[model samples]
Target: MKIKVLIADDHQLFREGIANLLFSAENIEVIAQAQDGADAIEKAKHFKPDVILLDIAMPVMNGIEATKKLK
Candidate 1:
């Protein structure tokens, strides 16, 4: 099965770049993208991706806090 992935970052270019890179991998799938930590949480709950890539610094909530909430 393909590994589902969720990417969360405040930078549009960075987020899209990562997503593009992940998409090149046959075993990985980019399921969703979030602009901030809060959006990441919401998408996580909905998509339930196998992996979540977060930016340490973001608006609304930081990666550390989002990781805690997700846990």
Candidate 2:
């Protein structure tokens, strides 16, 4: 099965770029994109992705805080 992934970042270009890169891999799938940590948490719960690519500095909670909550 493909590895499901969620990408969270405040920069749209960076997010899409990463998604494109991941998409090139046959064993990976980009499941969702989140703009901030809170959104990442929500998407993580809903999507239950196998991997999450998060930006450390973001609005509405930041990556570290979100990672703790997700854990």
Candidate 3:
């Protein structure tokens, strides 16, 4: 099965860039993208992605805090 992934970053260009790069990998599937940690949390919950690429610094909530909550 393909690996599902979710990317979270405050910068749209960076997020898109990463998504595009991952898309080039046939085994990786980009499931969703979030603009902030909180949004990432919600999307992660709903999407239940196999992997999450989170930025350490983000608005609304940071990656560290989001990781704690997600765990």
Candidate 4:
């Protein structure tokens, strides 16, 4: 099965770029994208993606906090 992924980053260009890269991989599927930590949490809970690529510096809650919550 394809691996569903969620990418959370503050930069729009970077986030989109990563999504594009993952889109090229046949085994990877980007389920959602979040612009901030809080959004990441919301999306994670909803999507329950197999993997999450999160940025360290994000608005609202930051990556570390977001990861903790997800854990």
Candidate 5:
């Protein structure tokens, strides 16, 4: 099965860099990206990615809070 991934980070460059790297992997796919914690949660709900890489701090909500809601 494909390894679906969602990137959640306040930094655009960091997110883009990781996304680019992941895109090179044949088995990995970046399904979506979010700039903040709330957005991340919303996208995660829609994307249902296998893994979500989130930064510790973000606007609207924090990664910890987002993770709680997701769990």
Candidate 6:
């Protein structure tokens, strides 16, 4: 089965670049993308991705805070 993934980053170009790279992988899928930590949490709850690629610094909320809330 393909591994579902969610990527969260404030940088649009970076996020899209990562998503594209993951999408090219046969065993992985880019399921969703988020602009910040809060958005990542919301998407995670809804999508329940197998993995999350998150940035440490972001607007609204940061990766560390988001990880705490998710856990």
Please give the distance, in angstroms, between residue 23's alpha carbon in candidate 6 and its true position after superposition: 1.3
Model 5 pairs whose backbones collide: none
- Candidate 2 per-residue lDDT, tens place, 10-61, comes to 9999999999999899999999999999999999999999999999999998
lDDT of 1 by residue, 1-71 (tens): 99999999999999999999988999999999999999999999999999999999999999999999999
TM per prediction: 0.98, 0.98, 0.98, 0.97, 0.94, 0.97
Q: How many pairs in model 2 have backbone atoms within 3 A of each other, for residues 3 or more apart or on separate chains, i.e. clashes? A: 0
Candidate 6, 1-71: lDDT as tens digits: 99999999999999999998887899999999999999999999999999999999999999999999999
Give the per-residue Cα lDDT of candidate 6 at 40. 100
Which run of 10 residues does model 2 get worst, by summed lDDT? 52-61
- Which candidate do you rate higher for TM-score, 5 or 6? 6
Per-model C-alpha RMSD: 0.4, 0.4, 0.5, 0.5, 0.8, 0.5
Q: Looking at candidate 2, what is the lDDT of residue 52?
A: 96
Which sections of candidate 6 miss by over 4 Å? Answer: none
Q: Please report how far candidate 5 places residue 40 from its true position, in Å.
A: 0.8
Q: Residue 29 of model 4: what lDDT?
A: 98
TM-score: model 1 vs. ground truth:
0.98
Query: How high is the lDDT of residue 19 in model 1?
Result: 94
Worst 10-residue lDDT window for candidate 1 reads 15-24
